[model samples]
Target chain A: MTHAVSNGLLASDLVKNFGSVSVLKNINFSMNADEAVGIVGPNGAGKTTLLSALAGAFQLDQGSILLNNQDVTEKCASARCNLGVVRTHQIPKPFDGMTVFENVLVAASYGVDADKQTAYQHTLNAIQLSGMEHVANRQAESLGLLDRKRLELARALATQPKILLLDEIAGGLTEAESVQLVDTIKELRRQGIGIIWIEHIVHVLLQVAERLICMDSGEIIADGEPQAVLSNPQVVKAYLGGGIE
Target chain B: MSQWTNSVTIQRWTPSSRYAIVFAGLVLVLLALAPLFASNGLLDRLTALFIYVILAAMWNALAGYGGLISVGQQAFFGLGAYFTIRIADLGLDPFISVALAALIVGVISYPISLVMLRLKGGEFAIGMWVVASILHLMVNLDGLIQGETGISLVSLNHYDSAQRLTIIYLLTLGSMAGLLALLFFVLRSKTGSAIQAIRDNEEAATSVGVKPEKTKQLLFVIAAFGIGVAGALWLTSATTFLPKTYFSVQWSAYMIFMVLVGGIGKFEGAILGAIIFFLVETWFSSTGVWYLVSLGAIAIAFSLFLPKGIWGELERRFNWHFLPVGYQVVEKNKINTDKK
Candidate 1:
């Protein structure tokens, strides 16, 4: 893939709250176009919330996000996606009434406002890349869990995203299936699509992610090279209460 | 961009579909010349059938593919009818006034939508009905509306029953065909794709750069436009325009019945449903109130047993579209092959 004109996504001092409860607390994050960052933490550590903020799913209380050096905190989710920020739900949200091909075709056509031929070409590429060509015409609701997850990835990829925010796409998968998903993520990372993946499967994440960040209570407790950050005492303490997992 | 790509032919219809096209075209030709041979009474029934189709198609497009269920479409229909007579009274050409009335009603929907679209699902349906009620009351207040006392179409007095029915029949056919074609093509375009996405899941659509509000707004206005024009034509043919009858909620009820019993999202379902409805009304009118009751019962039965509507059921079983609009992907080499 051709290099993006600027560095990838950047978020600074992001704070978000739902009513009286704060979900994300003063989080600062950044990723380069060539990097894959894995986020590991205990349940409810705000990893998904952080991803949501970046994805423009919800407005933050106070924060700024930059995409390729342009401020995008004010942009809506659709606009963010058009600017190449795409996300997949933890539970797949495929357009149920549509065929798998149509679900992805919507992304290809609207994600970048591509013409018919370009959208068709992009949809084909995305479906093939995510290994969904076999069931391309099947109604999305008919897909099993594994195929649904693959379609989620395919839909995101169809947008030609520069950054993919994956939220536990590996969740509920068998070991072999998890490894297969890792392979897809690895391929995307190799193609220079920056990835921010929130996954509990540390080993699978390790295969694809070049860096690791651990969060606790909506704030990152550790961030650095994958192995080093995973070995950090703060992260260890956060994960297992002062014991290593 | 490439020479090899130039040799590719984008397949639009299958062999059977091509045949269906020819047959449908011939039928349209026959219908266009219908007034030439048909009696006045038959021509009148045909005009009523045409109006029902126009209304049903508008409702289906809005509630089906657009996912904007609105019972308020009568607001435009009533507004269109009233505007037509009023504009005709102002000494403008009666033909041009109907078009103008349709345009005006469409404009009115822009603001009405701002207020009505805030409600979702069933609430949206009710909200539109409430708006129609307001329009019904407001039109009744106008002196020109003659309230329930009514007024005649100034243009009809210039022509006899045969000429008038012929003119209205021809006009209704042209408008219904034109609007349905436009709507069908729209459903095949990118906007159709986005509308379907919004219908499925607004959040997912937003993830892929579709603005749900903007797309829904477009559909709401388009529906208003078609219903508006249909209202104008219906009034033009009827000659007598009573605000109470013109702005009746029964129009909305009929529209909902047609689409719900026909198939909500599919194009042909609306047409088929309208045809069935027209047949029922004509054949069973001798039974009086029982006819309306039977219509209601059939609609309920269809909703329960054939939830997808009759045409939708047929399409599912046959895997076919009599009027294909929304696009489906087929591999280039397997273009002519049917899905299993």
Candidate 2:
């Protein structure tokens, strides 16, 4: 999270107001290369909003974002993705009519701007890494929940991102399915790609994230070591449903 | 004793349908040579068929792959006719005017698409139709276009009917085949992949670096250009350009009917649909307004009963493919050399 730089992402003074209600309140965030950071927040807490703004899916009322120490605050989502800042939607958004391979291949070629040979290699690597190789030729929409999420991750990874922002990828997954996803996320970390994962599952997040960020009402309430952030009284109060209930 | 081990060569690629082998160069050669001996009436009919095929194919690419449900494409189709007639009236070669009109209409589509594509789904569809009507009225104001009186392409009169019909028919045929090939290659290219990605999921496509606006705009102009040429061909056939008829929403209705019934998203569907539509129209168009009602009825029936359209339904049921651009896996174990 340090500003010293080395292929990391930084967002400063991020602010977004949706019709007078501030969804993101002057947030400053940073993540380093190969780092896995997790964000946990309650409903209406604006966690997804933060990811969207950073991803350029939404423009900030006020903010500047940088990828790999270069300013990309004004770039569209696709341009930001080409610059190695790629994100996955909270919901799986695989291209319905396209096969699973086509989805990843598209991301590999377009998002990361990989050349043809490289795109093919990257696509295969991504499908293999995300464990979607088995259903590579299947139409994306035909897949079930677990496979859809895998396709989503495979799609994102195929883009060859220097930094990846994940939003609610573990939502609606069974505990066992979430573990499989957590393992995939860990494998992504081993590939040296920086990750900013937003998840509702605290235990899964705790297992993978070295750093944890807690947000409530559009503001970061706690940021630090995962264990410490989870135990912080403000963090616990804001999220974690006030413990046992 | 020696024996063949029968070692199978396993590959990772998808299997292409063998049906394309049936559509080999022989068919193209036959089509190219048909007009030489065919009667003028048949040539006239074939020219109309070519134009509709172009319309159906372009509409399929726009609505099917790009998810741009524009029912107002006739605006450009009519514009192509008017522009051709206008250019031809200026004493330019009537045949060359088609290409010029296509380019001009394509450039015009850029600004228009920016405005038109801002609306999505039904609103976009309706917006385009309204735009077409406005264009139709605007074109009517031009005295050179002859307003409601219409204008014959008298420049083509010098060539005589037989020679003129053959040239235009061949050109129309050539243009249709060229554009269809272009559309096919585009869908197989990376841009096509990105375009389909936008169709399937715009937000997701954007997140993964597919430029929705750029891809869509490009497809819009390309489709406009193709449709404009088809319009020009229609003008050549009729030898006159009627703004009211050219700008009629019936063109879009016909395109939607063909694409929907044949296979809205399938490339082969456009061709097959156009062929079926051409035959049906020939048979019943003489029945007056009842023909229009039947077309409408057929389009509705296909949309309701066969949601995937004919080719889509068949592909799901029978795994039939004529233009299989996307990959289709066949397991290695299923590879039987005896069948080959």
Candidate 3:
């Protein structure tokens, strides 16, 4: 399938630290518009931290993050959101007391410049897209795991972001639910929303991401086509069992 | 064929049980008519209860809807009383002065919210307490407010005792009902949904495009205005303004207790809590330390076992709410004129 003209995101020498522990070290990467990239890493490899820096949830200890061509490294999360960059938490943090519909309504109204009627329509569409119509009025806290993950995606989609950062959204879903989620991601890609999925479900990532990068101790060890990156000697050593060739 | 019809039907299908509305209406009617059957002392107590309802409602709006649990709302209450008293000293009618005082308090609260909004969670609660203390100290030091001796509302002397008391009681009831109606309208609006979202999850709300600071500031100002009006009305009913009475932390504590026991996020909960609170206070007035002990015990019980409060628990169990906040979609039937 042909992709949209690539207005690639660029990060040069990204560095981040949590107190004395460095979580990301001189990380460099770029992805064109409509590109679907996946990052796989061991537990402490800073996959989530990198997503946070790119989403502007945290100030980078060092490095520049450019969306398209503009520097967004110093912007706050909301500011970056307005620039069409949005992220979902790995834990699926839907507003606990708010209903499923209300959650998306807020994103549609405030995330973009849509007016009330337009925002409402957009929110309804997002709900339909996320397949949350059955429980639209239910309190978010009352939802089970699968719905919570769907709510997380609905919220991100409502923002109408150009680039989406998804963090472990499939971590706890059943295999069938993960397949359904992967289909949803594929559907989003069909609409031309660039996606960066961080997942422990490596096979699902392989199904969706055209390119994959494996991280070990905060730095990318391999970046290439999915199969090639997964089978790279360094990736096999870092992720695959020690006995594997 | 039109989308609005579909939306209306969707809303109708999710109707909360009608019993909640009937109960809320029953309470409003009772409060409105209470003055006719009660003795003067009881009437005075009822008036105090009305003020408490408004104060508790404001606190619920701030903490329940806005997710801002303020322990310092009494500062606005005291400021409202002091400002009303000051304005009445210049010969304005006390009722008009109340409105003016609320406006002033609202304006002042915007800047105050700017500083306070910077703090989140525990820090925000502590900041409000500090603000309350500073205001309490300022009131105590001001010679014009009688420097802690307090000031008697000068205009109360102009009218006969009965006339003054009746007018004050009616004004308090009117203000309470009016504020309740206003809040009801606001919570039904699009902005109210945003506020609820913020309360649910600040980050999630922000991601969806809800500007947390703006929504919070707006609600904070409205709460401050409403509480200020309640404070002014309290002063008018009592015919005096005492710093200790107006700015006391106990007022905040009482408001919190009322909301917690009535229901934190439900509108009817505030009124229910206020009524129960007044009755408890009246019955236990002579009990002294036991009264304080009982109050604490009841509050703890509600928080621990009935976190939804009386109305909230009732609503959850029975699926009831007077003013609903979710959307409903309507279905349309098309007509054919084949015979014609």
Candidate 4:
């Protein structure tokens, strides 16, 4: 929250291919640290792939990613996370056999390079922020789906990320649970952490995201205000026509 | 809405765990004094059990905690023995050679880990075994080893039989205790958490800033060093090193059986598994092939029924944990009230 000169995340000319199929093509995306952006698309829209590329999950075929105006194309996933870009998996990937508190502790200790006391404090704060204090001592693998999703958010928050990339965090949650998650995400955005959420839940995503981007066939077809992007003809044809009731 | 309380304290050691520590220390001290009263054969058997403990614990830390199921540990075991003999041939005391050989094996494991760690799952297990086989063939080519006729550590003959046996027993015991202590401390630290996180999910760990490669490499090297020391001590006690016997895949099989019988991921399980294995081997050695067949049968039975191993089952049923590898969060007010 105290960052005075963060330029946020910038990705230019990103291209990625898997075998004979192209997943992402010539993508250019940018987001500031003070805004929340939502990405919505049909299946195989390269939305998650874009997030993966930004998070450095795999090598980009051709691209340059800049975090705070510094190129991070060569950095590995952990290195990118240390530089203030963190992500949550679409399906929760909690560290089994560890307590929920310990899952976030790993992020604070390694992501921020915090010492024991600082890391512990950060872990507690992340848990409290994500409303996971009740099950803080429980093993992560024992958690239900909603709590598991919250754990993913708590872990990302513990990293003290400037740009948080969330990949369909509310995919399988009930409507009430989705509302609760939206409240937590709203709180995060208010605290000045940028979030780029990829979701299939449009109305829920619209509650928190000021801006929205839509992609189809590995290319962004719409980028603007949430309503404006949603109403775009190409976006509707490529995504919302088949999705969104 | 009420403000969330953030005054919880993390507790790692319970009263039972604290008492367990004292009990373990007492047991170690009592075991250390065994040679003073126990017969030579018993002392020899105890020494062999200590070596099994060392190997099982190292493999447990590597495969159990690190998610690296390696069967090629005998490579380091054999290399450790060979290095000790080679170092002793230069006129060094065999005791010092044991330590030096272990250190050299640790260094050698770094490069080997670089190549081997790239392989995952079954590939890693089989790849390590292949590497061990290659090392065996290479060791047989050495002039000193003399094409599998092997070589004896003649340097050990300088000491009287009683002195040599006593020293070797002490060395093996010390190494087992030292390695366990090392693992305990490492698993209790931040790096320990990182390693476990990587084990559970490598890509997820990276998103949280855990370096999988570096953490796995450290564990691989540590396992090699400890297994190496065990091999060096074994050669010192036997005073002989046959390339075939030293690099035998049977060593890997022993480690797997012990970890499976005791518990795969628990520290106490490895020690427990090693002891059970030592006893089973002792009682059934006369049964020859039946000994190995029963060993396999027990391993299979444990896999089918007690898959978590004995320690894991006990912990699951009674919620008992003697080691401090995990954290327990308690509210500060609860602690204060409990004391009152």
lDDT of 1 by residue, A1-245 (tens): 12233678878889999888888888888888767889999999999999989999988899898888899999989999999999999989988878888899899998897888898777877877787767877899999999999999999999999899999999999998898888888888778899999999888888888889999998898888888887888888887765434
* Deviating ranges (above 4 Å) for candidate 4: A1-6, A240-245, B1-5, B333-340
Worst 10 residues of 2 chain B by lDDT: B1-10
User: Which candidate wins on TM-score?
Assistant: 4
Q: Per-prediction TM-score, please?
A: 0.94, 0.94, 0.89, 0.96
Chain B TM-score (model 4 vs. true structure): 0.96
User: In terms of TM-score, which candidate is stronger, 2 or 4?
Assistant: 4
* TM-score of candidate 2 on Cα atoms, chains taken together: 0.94
Residue-level lDDT of model 3, residues B20-53, one tens digit each, is 4666678778867766776888778878888988
True contacts kept of each: 0.63, 0.72, 0.54, 0.64
Per-residue CA lDDT of model 2 for B140-174, tens digit only, reads 99988768888888898889878888899899989
Ranking by lDDT: 4, 1, 2, 3
The superposed Cα distance between candidate 2 and the true structure at residue B19, in angstroms, equals 4.9
Specify the CAPRI tier of model 2: medium
Per-residue C-alpha lDDT of model 2 across residues A1-245, encoded as one tens digit per residue? 33655577788999999998999999988888778889987899989999998889978899898877788899999998888888988889989999888888889889875677687777777877787766877889899988998898889999888888998899899988888888888877787888888988788887788999989999999898987887788987885558512
Residue B290, model 2: Cα distance from true site in angstroms = 1.6
Using lDDT as the yardstick, the better of models 1 and 3 is 1
Q: Which digits, one per residue and each the tens of the lDDT, describe model 1 over residues B1-340?
A: 2222332323456665667778878988999999889998888888889889999999998988878888778889988899999999998877788899999988988888887878899999988888999988988898987778988887767777677778888988888888888898888888898988898889989998888888888889999999999999999888788878877888988998898788889888999899988988888879988887887888888888998898889889998766776555565666765453
- What C-alpha lDDT does candidate 1 achieve relative to the native structure? 0.85
Better of 2 and 4 by lDDT: 4
Fraction of native contacts in model 2? Answer: 0.72
